[model samples]
Target chain A: MTLDVLAAGILSGGLYALIGLGISLVFGVLGLMNLAHGELVIAGAYLASLLVVDSGWDPLLALPLAMAGVALIAYPLQRYLLTPLLRGDKSAPLVGTFGLSLLAQALFQGVFGTHPKSLPASYADSGISVLGLRIQTIYLIAFALTTVLCAATHLVLTRTRAGSAVRAASADPATAAVLGINVSTVYAMTFAGAAALAAAGGVLTGVAQSFTPTSGLPLLLTGMAVMALAGIGSVGGVLLAGIALGVLQSASVQLFGGGMRDVVVYLAFFLVLAVRPQGLFRKAATG
Target chain B: MIRSTSRRIHALGAAALLAATAGCAGNASSSSGGKNDDGGPIVIGTSISLSGTTVLNQIRDGYLLAVQKVNAEGGLEVGGKKRKVELKVLDNRSDTNTMVQQVRSLALTDHVVGLLGSCCQQNIDMQGQADALKVPLVMGALPVELLPKGKGYTWDSFQSLADGAKDFYTVAAGAKTDKKTLIVTNNDAQGISTGKLWGATGKKAGFTIAATKAVPTGTTDFSDVIKAGKSSHAQVLIAAMAPPDCFAMWKQMKALAYKPKVAVGVQCAQTPGWGSLGKLGDGTLVQLNWSDTAGLPETNLIVSKYGKKYTNLTDLGSVALGLHEATILLDAIKSAGSTDADAINKALAKSTTVSAQGPVKFVDNKSVTPTFIGQWEGGAIKQVWPAKGGSPLASLTGLG
Candidate 1:
């Protein structure tokens, strides 16, 4: 593949990493697969559209608020609804999150009117050349932002007192509760944090591509693929996995044409799962 | 315990029988194609994508408007009696399986004599359901060329892809370009057919096909496609994909600076949402089934009723299509003088009616509507071809 295609794929992978990180975080800590994670990503985009599209605010200016808004919405959901379900049937959270996904899709359609929407920006459809290689300006910004967020996420989990409580709760919730860690609060906070990351990715994705109410399914699958490839609890691996997916997709399109791009990536995903169920980049279980 | 279980099973059987009888009682007056003894409204059902990736709100509105106008006139006259038209609409959410199931239920369970169509590829899928159920189905939005030959249960009244492609080439003949074309389509039945038809039509118009690619739906990256177009130096670009795919491709095209002199986004750029792309959406051409300036029948009525809600040419065209399809179906029902499916189908074969898109007469189970090529200018689409009360072509400033 040409360097241009490679660059595009790598940059697009940054957004994928951002999307997968949230899903990976929730799965690692709570041991609950948040089917609504894709919705969370879309929720961020829709939330930002309120500010960016209606109020004419810069997407960058609206990103943090959108993140905060989605986090606020996710915190209580995990704390009250999802966390309690985790204590009961193992499948309840899965079903609950799936329900949330449907509900979110309905609410988006009802509220937004089913028209495809995007966050307009000066950089949305512009490109800049670096080292004689051209890249989309929005994707570049998204890549830089994704790297910083991933690093911040890693540092938060590895270097803070809050991080220690999260690790303690994730490793053994019952023991962490006995040790006065307030496991429920830690779980809620972790989910909320992951949701914020998804929102950030959502805003970036909106800037890069158009989204509809039902756009979350593809994104959810992509994130799931990244998580499956990267394994749980590896922030760096998520980034690598996202890039790997991006490169594979780009190369497949180049070699086998566009029709085979998804086929190749999905085949790789299935093969990776079959061969290494624990994942290709499985580090020590952070939990 | 065994005796108790046997008693419970008997109770369950009784309950099931009771529910089945109630269902039959509820549908006793419902008939698929015979005279209605209950003197109830004639039910015409449609399962459309009201909220999904491809929303047919305009088409649905057209169906409702036709129903409303007929009901306002005290309903359709059937077998020397006037009966109100009852429209049962179910949202399929753009899922083919859901659409199929909903269409089946509307025919067998609801016992509607006639069915109205959904948009795009769904209409093609609905054709099978219509034929298998032996219900008369009338639809627009799907091109005549894409309508697969099947049992004569489905009737399509819309612009033909061949006509649109020929009209596009006629428009392109006046434009300044090398005529080296690049065509990209989504890898679905409609998309594939569009690519082949347009490519063949372009060759007849003396345009050379430089590159052709078919990508699946939901493809966000178009760099490889762009690279092909650039390498081939294709000045005439044709893309047939969904709105979101076109949105991303348009953005990437501008970003990568491919700079095709002429571009037509079939089925993609027609959405009102294209205006959201602002300047990037400008100068892109779309095939319109109806234009206000074309002086089709009931244009004034459509404008008067839905002028405020639908301001753009694309949305208005969709509303017109809906109105056209509904009028044709209702007129067939009136001509048949009964709610019988076979009679309605026969009547549709001989249908000659005028609606929003002008005179429509079924020839080979299809009615070819007038085709008008429109271009996005400023934030709205204007009819730029047919040059009769239409605007002149503009440079593709969106690419630059």
Candidate 2:
């Protein structure tokens, strides 16, 4: 493969993995499929875009502030809003998250008015040349940050007391609760962490592409595909899945017309899942 | 109370106008069979994007202004009776599906004599619905693929300038100073359609199509496409995308120092946002069908009046085209005499009229007069082709 294509594939893969990490973390620990996770990303992007476009903040400067705002809402959303629904049937959380997705979409359109807005980030286009491949400075930076974040998540799960509690809850919430692990608290924190990762993905995605209110659906699908291929709760699995998915998707577009790219990627995802439902490299369940 | 009274007034006024026009039409028909008398106001129907994107409002206003001017001049005489022109307006909501439904609604329900205002490409595909219903669909801003085909049902869709869009060989034929050329297209129907158009032209133009990259729409990171172009040694970068994408690309192009002598773009280049590009938009030329700076008064007056109605000022590019569509439809209706769809369709098929745009006439294969090109010069889009109808020629400089 040409370095150009490879670079695009790899950089795009990194962002995909970041999104996957959020989806997987929530799905694995909370036992809730968050259809609204993509909405969270869209919200983060619009939040940052509003700051950059209307408030005149640099995108880089707005990222942390936007992340904080998301964090503030995300934790409460998980605790008060989501926890009440946990008493209902299994579909309650799923239905609630779906409603949240629609709500977020409506709110975005209501506030932003369905027009294209941009962050106008200064480093948006910055890139450096190496090995005859022009690597975008932003892509490289995003890739690096993704790796760091994923690694940090791994460390948190394996090394710290919080990691122990989170892994304990993911493996067996009832057992962890019996063991005095504050399982309810773990769920909220896990969801909050997922939200933060989603916020990061949003900032990176907005910086990488121009976004609108309607952009969340496709991005959400892509994130879901990556998560499914990577396997739930496996950080490293998500990375491999993202990379493989990104490369295959981009290469398919190059070989075929744009129409076939999605079909090809989804088929590949199905094939991988059929062959190894647990993922290509499934880590053992840990507590 | 106010709403009820206004509704009653509107209904009475509309019914009375309809009856009077029908009586005038019957008398005219008795006098001269079917030939136009050159003295009746025509009825035209337009379904444009009035609210979505705000810019569409400018375009709708432009068409209304054209109608206002024509009516003020006592309407065109058709067959032997004086009839005042009327415009039946519908808002398409900027949705493709809605556009098709609205066009059909305007034709079958509203009974508009002629159709106008399809500035976007996808919306023009809705013209097929119009064609199926046998209405004269006069669109001013659609690409070649969406143009009326085979049947004469799709009548004269005009362009403001002679567009060089069909010439793919220009890109291929031009000797490239740099080895690589990257084609960046937005991941949407318009962007894909433009990329296809460029590919057809580029293959003929003689430049090697090194890479065709699709950047997902609303993508914040453009590094992938820009780097791919750079690595490919694409000295020429062509993007078929919106203003935001271009803004992102240029910012990246500057940071990466990827300078090409011939960096051309398609779509939204003539928009006011491109003017904000300052020097960056400088060396970049685009294929355009019309520009306001060409000293076409019919064009200028449409802009001035439309500006007052829509955005309080007439600087938006799409507005001028929308107005042109409205006027052309009005011309057909005035020429046809009655508000009958069949009559107006025939009039549009045979009529030759001067638009706020250049002189326009329909040809065979459901196509209108050919298009020309325009470039943004010093914040004003100036026509720059054909030598005769073109803006003053300028030497090609590198895009920095």
Candidate 3:
């Protein structure tokens, strides 16, 4: 394959990793699947649209606001609505999250109208040539930003005291609660953090691609593919999985015709799952 | 006092329910005819995709605009009796199965004399229902030739894909480009059909079919296609796909620095979303079914009435399809002289009404409309073919 094709795939993987990071954080730390994760991502993009179109802010300038706005919404949603349901059957929250997705779609439609919207960024279409290999400037920025976020997230989960509390609650909620850690609050914060990441992914996606209220489903599928490949919780593994998925897609397009690319990538995903039940990258535990 | 209040409330609720039923039931109590009765207004129903990925609100608006205009003129004359045409619309929510169920209900329960068609696959699926239910279905925004030759129940008046292929070749002949062409299309029915036809037409026009690639609907990667375009060094490019698919491909093409001297996105570049790509979208060509610059019959009326909403030829094309489809159905009703489904089916097969897209006549339940080539200049589309009415064809620029 040409350097250009490989470059496109690698750049695309950065976004996939960003999408996967949120879902894995919630699923591994809070033990909540967050079926509406895609909606959260889309919600972030919608927030960016409001600022960029109405307030005339650059998309990059408004991205942090989008992330924060979605985090605020997610924090309250987890605290008030999803947390209560999580106590009952797991399916309750799953069902509730689905309903939330529908509600989010309706709200997006009502506020933004049903038209497809894009957060216009000058860098969205601009590109840079790195030693003769052309790459989209927006994608290059996204890759750099994702690397920073991944590093920061990894540090928060391992090095910080709050991260220790989150790990304690995730490992054993009852024990963590007895140890003076508010399990519910930890869960809410974890969900909120995951949401912020998802929103960041959404803003990047909005800059690169056009989005509608229904844009989340494709992203959800991509996130799931990365999560499945990465196995649930390894931060580094998630990044690798994202890159793997992005490369798989680009490679598929290069080797097979573009018509059969999806078929090839999905078939490869199934094969990997069947062969390695844990995942492609998960480390085996020692007794 | 409580007992009296409850009785009054119950009585009012019952009275309101009865009145609503009576009104929706097509005035059956009056001899003027039930909603479907020839004596009353002739009802035509459609289940349009108002939401979801395949939103056709422009097409829906077109139907409403035409239907409302007809009603304003005191309705259509059927069988020497004056009848106001009432349109029954249901939001299909962009579900094909839901559209099927609604179309059946409209024909069977609502007793609408004829049916209107939605765009793309929905219309394709509705054709079978129209024939099985024996209700005349008037449809546009889809090439009728694509449908399997069916009974005389479904009549289509839209542009032809083969015609689009021919038109593209004719224009590209004059533009400066090597005769090598790369054809990329979606794996879906319409994409494959357009690719096959356009490839043949390109070959006939003395251009070599350098490479052809087909991708799925939700495809976001165009690396393989880009590689092919680059290696093959095809001077001409044709991608027939949905708008989203084209959007991704367009960006990737630029990122990889593969610039075709002449490129046409058959179905994808027609969307207003293409404008969001900034100057990267300039000089990208698309085949048109309707253009404000073409001076087609009733185009001014269509544009002026719904100008604010549609705002572009790409969108106006669908609206014109909906309007033309509705116009033919209305014309058929007048010719049928009865709201009877069978009679309407017969008359629709023989329908010949001049529409915004010009004279519409169905031969074998299909009619072909003119196809024009257009280009995205800045944020708007300009008709660039048919030098008599449109601007001269411009060379490809600003792609890289």
Q: TM-score for all predictions?
A: 0.92, 0.74, 0.91
Cα lDDT tens digits for candidate 2, A1-287: 65666667787889898888888888888888898998788778888877876677877788887777777778988886675566455676776788677667756766765544445554565567888666667677778888888888888988999999998988888799899998777888888888888888888777765555666777788888888887877888777778877777667656664556677888987887898887764663221
Q: What C-alpha lDDT values do all the predictions have?
A: 0.88, 0.66, 0.81
Q: Mark the 10 consecutive residues where model 3 chain B has the least summed lDDT.
A: B24-33
Best by lDDT: 1
Model 3 docking grade? acceptable
Model 3: per-residue lDDT, tens digit, B1-400?
Answer: 3444345445545755774464346223112224676376788888887655667778877787788889899888877767787788776767889888888888778888888988878888999999999999988878757766877788888888778888888888888888899999889766787788888888888999999988898777666778788899998999898776777777767766788988898877887867766677788998889888888987888888888887778888888888888888888888888887888788877777898788977788888889899988876789888765888777777464
- Residue B307's lDDT in candidate 2: 49
Q: Record all residue pairs in model 1 with backbone atoms less than 3 Å apart, i.e. clashing.
A: B33-B340
TM-score of 2: 0.74
Top candidate on DockQ is 1
Q: Where is model 1 more than 4 Å wrong at Cα?
A: A284-287, B1-35, B95-105, B108-110
Residue A30 error, candidate 1, Å:
0.7
Provide the lowest-lDDT 10-residue window in model 1 chain B: B26-35
In the range B1-400, model 1's lDDT, one tens digit per residue, is 3444345445545755775575345333323443243678898888888765667888988998999999999999997889998887777877899899988988877788899999878999999999999999999888887788989999999888899999998988788999999999999876787899999999999999999989999999999899899999999999999888999999888888889999998888888778888789889998898888766788899999999998988888889999889999999999999889999999999998888888878888999988999999887998887899688999888986
Candidate 2 lDDT by residue in tens digits, B154-194: 65455422245543234323434553557888877657766
